[model samples]
Target: MNVFEVRGGKKLQGEIVPQGAKNEALQIISAVLLTPEEVTINNIPDILDVNLLIELLSEMNVKVNRTSRSTCIFKADDVNIDYLHSPEFKKKSGRLRGSVMLAGAMLARYKKAFIPKPGGDKIGRRRLDTHVIGFQKLGTQLDYNQEDGFFHLTAEELKGTYMLLDEPSVTGTANIVMAATMATGTTTIYNAACEPYLQQLCKMLNRMGAKISGIGSNLLVIEGVDYLGGTTHAMLPDMIEVGSFIGLAAMTKGDITIKNAGINDLGIIPEKFRQLGIAMDFKGDDIHIPSQDSYTIQKYLDGGVLTIYDHPWPGFTPDLLSIVLVTAIQAHGSVLIHQKMFESRLFFVDKLIEMGAQIILCDPHRAVVIGLEREHQLRGITMSSPDIRAGVALLIAALSAEGKSTIQNIEQIDRGYQNIDTRLQALGADIKRVAI
Candidate 1:
């Protein structure tokens, strides 16, 4: 592994072009297995999760070639479905939640899929019920041994119908969309996750000869076809990282600009940041972040103290709660950070507290951040990254601290952000990647 040794207190400046969305790239790569033809993907992120997904694809007999640093061509003309059930596959699946999506892809193409317990941030119970339930609606029979953490699902032909998901589970929504691609009839999915990543999945499927309407809305209408042909598609930019960099530039009192952000697709992320009194000038797709000495947290509607929280799509993403929480520490006023998703995600505030941040960990799920502003700058301290978003949050925190800090468990950060250290270094950030 890799560790980031950052000497904080320097304002990061310059520009960065974000790579493709990690979440989007993961699902699109898996979608290649649905057709026995060459599929080209552009703007693929250079990250661990993408690499792992490519490894899984290779195991399935897909001929994957790295055409460029940020592009790949996948041909699954001779895929072997049994590879999806291997122990190596199972072990690798636990690395991230994206692995769970493979079940739907395998079941759609081979009419059978074997999957082990999926892994991701242990924020709370990341339920698979929505996924299994959706598959069952398409005539899939699910068999499993809970003791061994393996699942086997099979069906002869999938017949789609109207289905309401138990909840708007993001991965579950993506799974159903993948499985519904080649089903026998039309599939209507209500309460679907219309997040940007899922929208990218729909676009890729459409290019692959799957008929899907309602790309960015809750109700998805998918007309399953007999076969899906391969095609080339470009993935979207990472919205979470765009949000992260926005917060980073603000908290450190720096001037920076993000190059070529997919501004039209950001949805409510910019507005969410604006709620905390962070705004920027839009130069086409790039956001110009100016140096600000302080930020005043906006009051809540109906006149109360300010509070920032996370919800499902079109609302703020839970993955960015940590970033938002840490950024709140540098604003001019205090704000309540309510993380409505996971139980243990906010516990890392103690680490920031150790670095002299004024944070009240109200409970397992909430933290009230008292902004330090210019009164106190964080003192550098060694910390371990707990999860993907949290790890980057820690990195952002360390970047603004007053001394040298060593951050371990960088693989957690690597799973999400593509070439994070390299990108940060380009922005004049004093960060170096090295072995611990």
Candidate 2:
């Protein structure tokens, strides 16, 4: 196991570049299986989840070449379809949630796909119904074995039709879109997820000769194509990490500039941080957060407490709510953190409370935070990470606390953020990664 020992009370200053998008990397890497030509991808984050998915692809005999630390070329001219049925395949695929996306590309090319139940953060009940129903809409037969926890899907020839998803699930949308690209007719998807992750997938497929419209909208139309070719695609900067750094600068009173943050796609993240009284200067594509001694939480004009909640895309992302909650600990006023998407995410507030913050866990999905106003600094303590986003949030909290803190199970952190300790150390953070 690995742990992070952080000596707190140091102000981090300097420029930090956010890693490439982890969420988008999963979808884009899976798309490479749709074609047999060389698909070159740049700006790939060297993280555990993506590396594991790439290993799975290699195990299936897909030609993968590492051109650089952050660039890879993939040619799936010959695939080991028999490997997908082995026990080893199920064991490896169950390690990461993104493994579920392989079914889309596999089914599109081979007319069959099988996978064990995917594994990922245990934040909530992440249902696979969206993916199953979307595939069934395109004339695919689905079967599940409850005892072994495996999914079997087969299709002779997919005929595209209209599909209205129950929710705009991001991975669900990507899976369905990839499957529909080679169908026999036009496929229309309503209530599709339009996040940049899906948008990038659609654009990449379009470059590879897939007919897709409605790139950044809730409705997508894909025309069936006989074949797809090779293409090059680059990933966007991770918005979640950008939000995490913005919260970190506010908590530690640091002057930090995030370079090449993909400013236009950030949507309401910068404004949402401003709602918590964290000011940011946008200089071109970079976000500059100036050092401030203190900041005040905002309230409604009717004298109501401020509430930060998550919604679908084009709204505040749910991934950064934990960071925002921790950032509000030293603000001037109280704020409500509503995690509408996941139930178990807010349960980690008890760890923060142990570190001398005033927090009330109203329910499974809501918390009321009363700022200490810098009157008393938080005293760090030993804690375990619960999920990827919450793990980074606790690290931010540890950076601003008064004493040393130890965080275990940092593999959860490693699964998303690339070289986190090294990157933060470059900005003057007192953190060290040690083996336990």
Give each model a TM-score.
0.97, 0.99
- Write candidate 1's Cα lDDT for 1-436 as tens digits: 7799999988889898877988888788888888888999999899888888888888778899998968999998898877777777888888867877788888888899877877877566777899999999999999886766788899999988899987888888999999998899999999999988898889889988899999899999999988888899998888888899999998888788989888988888888788788979899999888888888788867777787788888888888889999998887788888988788899888889999999999999889988887689998999999888999999999999899999999988888887899889888899999985
Against the true structure, whose TM-score is highest?
Answer: 2
Clashes of 2: 0
Quote the positional error of residue 198 for candidate 1 in Å.
Answer: 1.2
Looking at candidate 1, what is the lDDT of residue 254?
Answer: 78
Q: What would the per-residue lDDT of candidate 2 be over residues 54-171, giving only the tens digit for each residue?
A: 9999999999998886999999999998888788888888879899899888888888998787787979888889999999999899988787677889999989999999999999
- Distance (Å) between predicted and true CA of 41, model 2? 0.5
Worst lDDT 10-window in candidate 1: 118-127
Q: Give the TM-score of candidate 2.
A: 0.99
